[model samples]
Target: MFDLIIRNGKLYDGTENPWTRLDIGIVSGKIANIGDLGHEQARIEIDAQGLAVAPGFIDTHVHSDLLCTKPEIHKIKVLQGVTTELLGQDGISVAPVSELTKPLWQKQLKGLNGDIGEWPWHSIDEYLKFLDKSNLAGNVVYLVPHGNIRTLVMGFAGRKATRNEMQQMRELVEEGMRQGAVGVSSGLIYPPNVFADKEELIEICKGAAKYDGCFVVHIRNESHRSLEALDEVIDVARQSGVCLHVSHFKVAGQINRDKYEKALAKMDAGRAEGIEITFDQYPYTAGSTVFHAILPPWMHSGGTSEMLERLKDPVIRQKVKEDFQSNLDYENWVLNCGWENIIIASVSTEKNKRLEGKNVLQLAEIKGVEPADAAFDLLLEENAGVTMVVHWGNEQDVIYGMKHPLQIVSSDGIFGGKPHPRLYGTYPRVLGRFVREKKALTLEQAIRKMSGAPAQLLRLKDRGFLREGYWADIVVFDPDTVLDRSTYEDPLQEPAGIHYVLVNGELTVKDGEYLGTTAGQVIRRKT
Candidate 1:
């Protein structure tokens, strides 16, 4: 007898093949058989009625750092057919925290990820176990974040690391990988990380290379010097000989729209020269991040409290406003035109609740200040806890990236407050808007991007495909009807047509409702 069997489904199999009608048998949470198993017996069974079935989706790029407090985030993902989540994107997360740095790290990360509270810093391995023990609906994987280590040793300084600090950074990377991290992720656009020079990253990459881990980077300068930034990361791969993956790879700002193809060619050149490189893109054109990140890097040098203090200072505030006017980084970086382009997605304080859906320009209009000054004021008022969605990337760029063989899908999802629509709708939106509507990618190709491609990237042993002996992570959905319901204004809405989702042979979502079952495991890197 087996644990369960899902029968009569059209299986995509997570490859470059058409869906084939098949019956899947599950035993001990692994796929025991495919095709006819008419006589097989199981403890529990599901009749899929020939609806499309594929490997459960894997979100390669995500920021679910608050999983301990909000395991229901699995509902948001599993409901959309995501069975695994990779966290610790953009160089920051809760793990590897120390008694000295925990408070400071927590304060710094609040704006980027919603405050999950000051949880005690255990080792990264124990943190992952804590999440699994919380019973999240699906598996969790993580990348050792660069910012966490930097903060632990340097405390968000905007300068090069000392020789001693560099060694410490490398040792931390080794420690995190030893504790089961798949790789290292650097948020070069975020502070401390922004200050992390190429030599520092290349050395860390070499350290991660020792363990066969990929270096995931959110490269510096996605606008005016986007291609130059690409060259820097490519150079890092070249110097270290580590595999590289770019996060949410896109050119922001209106002026740089034409540079998308050139950016692709640069990455391709790196790939051609034998640097293993790939990228992840959400289906949507609008991207999300914390509003404060749009400001120049200098403002964030000393951690959140100090940053907030500077924001409140009239002289320092003028400098920020001047930078915005001078178009140093803000104008051509995230917000293309003005502050209104950045719609507020979330705010931590109830006092700033009304600002959640409004842009900085709108807030400024309400407060009778310039948009720059208003943004500064709001950050101070809320203690710098704010997130925003920037409507900037072109639909053409999104499609261009998604069509490339090297690129895969990732939500870069954040949670709580008014999160980005991708948090709820990334997978379905691709299946719905891009695949079904735009015809940019065939269903077979889209599934591979979400499943097989990511599994390969993570080097998973038994998941990401519909082959027997793989873990029974599967999704059954209606292709004709699957579509995202969330929008920029109402991002909390879930998608439609995801009928059933299974993680480790345990049904987590059935008939579009979460079963509240926690079968998720902390997927460790194979040493």
Candidate 2:
């Protein structure tokens, strides 16, 4: 007998094809059949009348590295119909830390990944095994973080790696791929990663390429220098022969808005030149990340503790302000988008929690200090654990990226107090705003970006399609009413219209509520 049967639903099948009226049968955690299924009998049956049944969404970028261990609190992903998440993004994550560097990463990543007290694993294999033991809400995949590999070989050093050190980092990358990482990820604007030269990146990409793994990167700059940064990564892809996926691709700042078409053309040209290129972006103009990322890369050279110490030094603070005024080489968020456009999103301490949603300008007034000093003090007070949402681009630009044939959807969501609405709203917002309202993408095309496209990019074998003989990871939602309710101010709200979700043929969400079933598995790259 079939384990379950979903009836009377229109299936999109994740192939960018037209939806067809069909029923699906699931058995032993796999899709057994897809057709009329009227004569099928099952242990359980779901009447999905008037619902769109498709492959469960795969979030291509997420910071759920530490949060995945707590399935109860991590249900936000599944509630939005995400059945699998690609973690270890932005080149910094929990695993592959040495006893010495563990504390450093813990401190550095607290704002982005959260402080989960003590981490249990220190290697890629151990971390994956830990996820296997945890009660995960959805399937999890990983990319070997470039920062972790670099810190393992050299502890957050600001200088370029020596040849021997580069070899060591490459070896670590190979070890991670052998242990099942599907790719390698780096956040070039973030420190340690920022210190890496292009040659180092090419070497690292070669390691991932050896395993047929993709190279996912948050490029060095997303504003005025965006074109150059794009060229740099494209060159890395050309040299290493790795598939390249840019994370949260955008041309930020009003000054650089004109570069949007140019950036897309650059990507097109790269693809035409035989370099595989794809990108994932949240359907929003505002970008979110740790607030400390605003500082010049040199200040973050010694790690979080040392950076925090430097923040207290008047000389160093003056130097930082000077760089903010003079430096056009780095991302320099505060310079591109004014301090008023950068709003604090999260903080660790109770005293600073009140500052969560306030911009640095408001924070300056409240603290009776200059905007720069107010931000600097907050970073010190929070021990460098501060996150922010920077209003960086326009809605039209977001739509432009969405319509690109090579683009896929990803939340790029980071969670904490006053998190970006994208964390809770990304998938539904696309279905509602972009598809239903704006007409930027059709319903079928949207589903393909969120589902099949990401799955293909990550090389997931069987989870991204509603096909017979595939795993039964599915989402059933009301197309007419599907919409995201979360907003920047009230970011904790869940989405509407997602009624049923299944992971590995097990029902995890029923009637728009989580069923508390931990049916997720750790999906490792096939070596």
Candidate 3:
């Protein structure tokens, strides 16, 4: 007998094709059938009348690596219909680190992933195994982060890799890929990773390419040099012959709003030359990151401890202030340092909980200091790591970019205290706010962007579509009722209208309630 049968649901294939009613049969953790199974007996049945059924959402970018270690995060994410989450995004994760460098990597990344307890330093496979033991509700796939690999081979010493060091970095990539990394990801704007020269990246990509893996990057800069960063990414793909995926692709500063056309032209040019390139973007205009990252990358060198020490020196602080002014527009400064834009999204330091919803600007004013100075002081007081929501991107740019066929939507999601609303709201906002409500895209097109498009881009073998013999990772929702309720001011609210979510033929969320089951697995590259 089949394990379950979801009958009478309007199946959306996440393609341009029209929707149709179908009955899905599941057994042995795989799809047993997708057509009429009128006589088929099953242990359980769900009559999804008047509901829309599609493949579970695949989040192309997520910082849920640490959250996957907690059982409750699955309650939030699985109920939102995400079946697969890509971890180690934006060049930060815990894998591939040796015992000595482990603490530094964990502390540096805590802003995004949240602080974790002491863990052993092991291979990439062991890290994945640890996550599996946590029993979260969604399948997870990770990119072997280049930053961690760099720290593993070379300490936080700010220098280019020598020939021997490059080989060691390469061997690490090869080993991680063999241990089941989906690909390699790097953040050129983030330190240590910012230390990576072109030769180092090319070498790492070469190793990842050997496994037919793709490289995803958060380009070096999103300001005046955004186009140049685009070109650099394209060149990496061309030279290494590995597929490239750009993360949170956007032009941040006001001056760069008009530069996206040029960015598009660059990607098109590369594609014309047979280079493989694609990109993902969040739906909002405000970008989120650790407040310390906004400092001059040089000041952040040698890791958080070094940075905190430097913050105490007046000379060093003066130099960093000058660097910030030079990087930002003095005449028309569009910074998010104040309370209007700088909300404390998450604070691992227990004493700072009161700052959670307040903007940094408001906090700065109360302290009778400049926002920049307040930002500097807070970082040091918080151990040089505090997450901030920066109002950076242009709304016009965000809307225009989402309309592109090549631009898939992602959350850049984090499950933390007063977190960015994108974690809970991105998918529904794309469907309810963007497509149905705003008319930015039709229903079919939005589904394609969220489901089949990303799955095809990552070349996930059988997921992201509604078909026979595919894994039964699916979501059932009411199209008219679906909407994201989370807002910038109150970021902790859940979304509305999603009724059920299944991972590998088991329901993690059923009838709008979390079932507390952890059927999720680690999906590895099939070599």
Candidate 4:
């Protein structure tokens, strides 16, 4: 007898191959058998006659570290059939934080990570323990946040690291790895992390290399200096002998749309020299982050409080606006893409709630102020606690990114209010729009990127493939009819055609409805 059985399904096997009719039996949450069993008995059996049975999807890039604090909103992910989420993205998260500095870091990260609720642990192991106490919608794997490490040693200072500071940073990373961080993540485009030089990055990556971990980077720039940033990451990988994975890889701005091939060619050249590199991209043309990211790196120095004070000065704010306006030669999102292309996604205060769906340009025109001034004032009012959807990615880039052999799928999903549609639509949209409709890729290839690819990247020996003896994390969906219903207007709408989902042999969603189960556990590094 088996705990559960799925019969008559077209199995993709999490690889680039045509589907084959197969029977999968689950016993004790691991795949126990994978052949036709005459007169097999089970407590529950699902007749997936026409559905595609594949490994549960893995979202490689996400900002769920802080948002996971709000469990009620996790249904958006469950409905999309995401069985695992790579948390602690962009080098920002809630572990390894000093209790003394945790309050400040939490305040500064509100725009990017949303609010950090009652889950407060200052060390990586403690954070994991806190997660274990709660039921999650999906499994979560963690990266040692580089920003948190930097802040622990330097407190958001904007400069090169001193020798002593460098040593301390390395020890912190080593400690995190000892506590089971799979790798270290860097957001070179963001503060504190941006302060470190290549040598400093190499040192931390070396710590990760000790455990056979990869260096996942949100590269420094994806616009004017995208190539330069790629080269820097490549150089770090080569020098430190660490594997590299780029997060949310994309070129931004209208003028930079054509740079994707060149950016990719640079990575290919590095790969030819024997450096292992992979990148993850969402299926959407627009990306979301804190609206405060529009400011130049220096403006963010001295922490969030200081930045707010600077924005209060009319002369300083005007100079900042002028600087952005005159810098169209680079990937300044607002300057190159215009404020109208940036839609406010959320705000922390009730006074700004009405602006969530509107663009800064619209708000500016209504308030009788320049768009830049309006943006600064809003950030000042909200204490920089704002998020936005920036429509800077080109459609051609998104398509080619999906087609790249080295590219994998991730949602980079953010949740709160009027969130990016990717939060609800990524996996289904890939199956529906890319595979079934446009034929950009075969269904097999799409499944490969979402399942096996990320599973391998994260080094999970027991998940990401529907094989005997592997954890029974699986999804059954009507490939032909699976569709992402979420749109830019109704960003919170649930998806369609996901018939069933299971995590660790437990049903989380059945018959297209969530069962409100939290069967997920913390995924740790094998070493």
Candidate 5:
């Protein structure tokens, strides 16, 4: 008898094809059969009479590197039908740290990646092994972080790598890929990574290319010089021969919204020239990240400790304010969106807990200080551990990105106090608002972007499809009623219409309720 059988479901099969009536029989954690299995016997049966059965959603970009070890928080991903996720996004994550650098990264990344107390692993292999023993809620894959590699070779010094240091960093990249990383990821806007020039990126990318891995990057700039930034990465891919994937592709700011078409044309031209290019984006006009991202790159030169010290100096603060007003060179959130659009999402100190969910303008009035001073004081008080949501774009631009042929879906979710609604509402929001209401994408196209497309990009085999003999990671939801209930104000609310979810042939969510199962496995890149 089959271990489990799902009957009478309209199967989408994770492709851009129309749904078909079918039944799936699961045995020993893989799909044993897919057909008219109405007559089949099973130990358990789920009658998905009106639900759409498709491959489980694969989040292409996420910051769940540390959070995945905590089932209480990570189970929320499965409740929204995410059975697999790609972690180690933005080139900053936990792993491959020396005893000296570990504390620095923990302090710097506290707001972006919530504090997880103490860590046990120092290498990517050790980190992945730790997750294997942590009883994860969903399958996870990782990318070797550029920041970690940089800090390992040279402390977070703001300078280009020497030839010897370059060779060492390249060796580390290959070592991580050999340890089963799917690719290499870098956040060019985040320092030590910001210090890396195009030559450094090309050198490191060649290592990932040697393993046939993709190079996923949060480009240097996403606002005024977004096109130039795009060209830089495209050239890196061309020179290194690594597949390129842009993380959360967007043209931020009100004025830069018109650059969307030009960006797409550039990507199309790159693809036409035989370079593989793809991107993932959340369906939102606003974007979220650490609050310190608003500062000039030079301010973050040495590390978080150095940056905190600079925040204390009045002369440096003046320079910072001047740069905020005039520096169009970096992704200046202050110049493009203003302080009112930057809302504080999370803070590390109890004194600043009340500041969470308030914009800098509001904080300025409450604290009786200028907006820049208020933000700087919070950074100092919280030790650079503050996160913010910046309203940088509009709905029309979001819709346009969704309709792009090479685009995929990823929440880029950051979990903490008053986090972005994308943390809970990304997939259902697309199914409800974009597909059902706005007609921006059909259900088939949306499912493909969430499932098959990411699988193809990551080169994941025997998953992301409903084919026979594949691993039984699946989701059943009502297309007509599936919708995200979470909002920016009530950001913790769960979604609706996700009836069932399975990871590796085990049901984790049944009848819209989480069963608290940890059936997920650590998916490694196959060499």
Candidate 6:
């Protein structure tokens, strides 16, 4: 008897072709049989009638490196049909961190992943060993964080690396790769990483290239300076001979909405000229991040404590406000702090729970203050530790991004706070809203974007397809019944129509509820 049998499902095999009816059999955590497994008995059997069975979704960009360290994070991610993810996104995560910088890096990103609750490791390999023992619900791969590596070699100073420092940083990256990092990643838009000049990026990328890994970049700017940022990435790929994967490829700001085609053209041209570029984007228009992203980079240079100190100085605070006002669109900026849209998904501090899910704008109006001022005040009150989502992406841009072959989809999901609906909603939204409801893509094409494409990119051996020998990372759902019920107003609601989800041949989520089985492994490079 097989371990489990999923019978009577229409399988979308991630071939970018039509769905085919198939029966899947699993044994010992691998796909044991496909097609006519009709008469075979199994230890467990699932009647997958009227469901579309396909490979479980792989998230190419995520901030879950720190989240997975916590045990509860599994239920939140697995229920969304994510079987694998590319962690250490946007240049902030704990890998390749030195003893001197670990404490500060932990504090700086507390808003993104929450406090590191007694993490014991110091090196990338040690952390991976811990992850293996953590027993996550799905597989995780990492892009060795550029900011973490830079901070390890050079402290959190906003300056270019010296030649000696640069060499040491390169060595650290090589070490991370040897320890199983899939690639190097950076947030040229965030501090410490923002401090690295283009030449520095090129050097680190070259080290990644030695391991045949890609360089995943959150470019310097996404609005006014998007083209320049894209060009810089292209130049890095050209010089370092590393593949480039652009994270959350979007044209932000009202004025830049029309620049999508132009930006895409530049990327296409670079690829034609041998840059080997691919990118990932979310299905939504609004982006989510910490409230601090609006502050000028210089104000955040020394670290979180130093940044808060400057916040107390009237002159510096005023300058910070002016800088934010210059870039922030006042009319559209929603107060994510406490509003109908601002749901508090996770709060490390017990006292802040009362502020959850209320609009920052509404809260500000109640306090007789501006929205920015309210956001600033909330951050200070929370000791510069609050996560917020901005309502600023254009639907046209989201739709436009979906139609691109090179642009795979990712949620950029921030787990804390009443997180944006996209965290739970992105994959299903793409399958249900974009594919089945709107018909932007055929069901076959949609599955390819989520499954086949990302698997090929990440170089997973036999995970993304429906072949007999692949791992049983599968999802079975009804296309007609599939829909993302989660919304900005109620972000925690589970999606509907996903009948069963299996990871490593074990059912982690079955019948739309978590089964509490943790079969996820830390996916490592084979070489």
Give the runs in model 3 whose Cα sits over 4 Å from its true position.
328-340
By summed lDDT, the worst window of 10 consecutive residues in model 4 runs over 327-336
**Cα lDDT for residue 269, candidate 4:** 86
lDDT of each: 0.84, 0.93, 0.81, 0.86, 0.93, 0.80
Query: Residue-wise lDDT of candidate 6 within 304-403, one digit each (tens)?
Result: 7788888778788777666654543222233211233442344446687666666666767766887666767777887767776655557877887788
lDDT of 5 by residue, 1-527 (tens): 99999999999988789999989999999999999987789998999998899999999999898888888988789988999999888889897899999998998888988877898989999999999998798999999999999999999999999988988999999999999899999999998899999999999999999998999999999998999999999999999999999999999887887788899999999999999999999999889999999998998899989999999999999999999999998999999999999999998888878988899999999999999999999998888888999999989988998999899999999999899999999999999999999999999999999999999999998899999989999999999899999888889999999999999999999999989899999999997
lDDT of 6 at 290: 72
Count residue pairs with overlapping backbones in model 2: 0
Better of 4 and 5 by lDDT: 5
> For model 2, what is the error of residue 457's alpha carbon versus the real structure, in angstroms, after optimal superposition?
0.9
Model 2 per-residue lDDT tens digits across residues 291-385: 99999999888888888989989999999999888799899998899999999999999998899899999999999999999999999888888
C-alpha TM-score for every candidate: 0.97, 0.99, 0.96, 0.98, 0.99, 0.94
| Better candidate by TM-score, 5 or 6 | 5
Off by over 4 Å in 5: none
Extract clashing residue pairs from model 1.
none
Ten residues in sequence with the least summed lDDT for candidate 3 = 329-338
List, residue by residue over 1-527, the lDDT tens digit for candidate 3.
89999899988888857888788999887788888878888998888999988888889999888778676754677778888888877677889788888889888887778766876646789888888677878888888898888888888777788888988887888899899887899988776888888888888888888988889899887767788778887888888878889999888666677788889778878888998788899999887777677776677678888988988898988877676656542211224232366677777778877777778678787768977677778887788658877777677788888888788889898766787889779888888888877888877787888889888876788788887778888999988988888898887778888998889999777777888888888888778
Tens-place lDDT per residue, model 1, 1-527, is 77888888788999769988778988888998898877988888888884789899999888777753465654788989999988888887777888877887777678766655557556798787777667678888889999888888888788999889989989999999999999999988787788888999998888789898999889887777788898999999999888999999988877889889999998888888998999999888778887778778888788777788777788987777667766644324434556767888888888778878887778888999877778777777777678888887778888988999998899988776788899999999999889899999999999999999999888898899999899999999988899999987788898998999999989889999998888888899997
RMSD each, Å: 1.6, 0.8, 2.1, 1.4, 0.8, 2.8
Model 4, which residues run further than 4 Å from truth? Answer: 328-331
Model 4, TM vs. native: 0.98
Error of 1 at 409 (Å): 0.4
The sequence of per-residue lDDT tens digits that candidate 4 reaches over residues 1-527 is 99999999999898777888889999998999998955798998999999999999999888887655445778667678788888877787777888767887788777767765654688999988888777787888899889999999988898999878888888888889889888999988677787789989998898888888889999888887788889999999999888899999999876776678998998888889999889999989888988888887778787788889999888888778777978643347777678889999998899888899899889898779989888998898888899999988777779988899899999999877789999999999999999999999999999999999988888889889889999888999999899999999988888999999998899888988888888888888887
- Prediction 3 TM-score vs. true: 0.96
Clashes of each: 0, 0, 4, 0, 0, 14
Candidate 3 versus truth, CA RMSD in Å, comes to 2.1
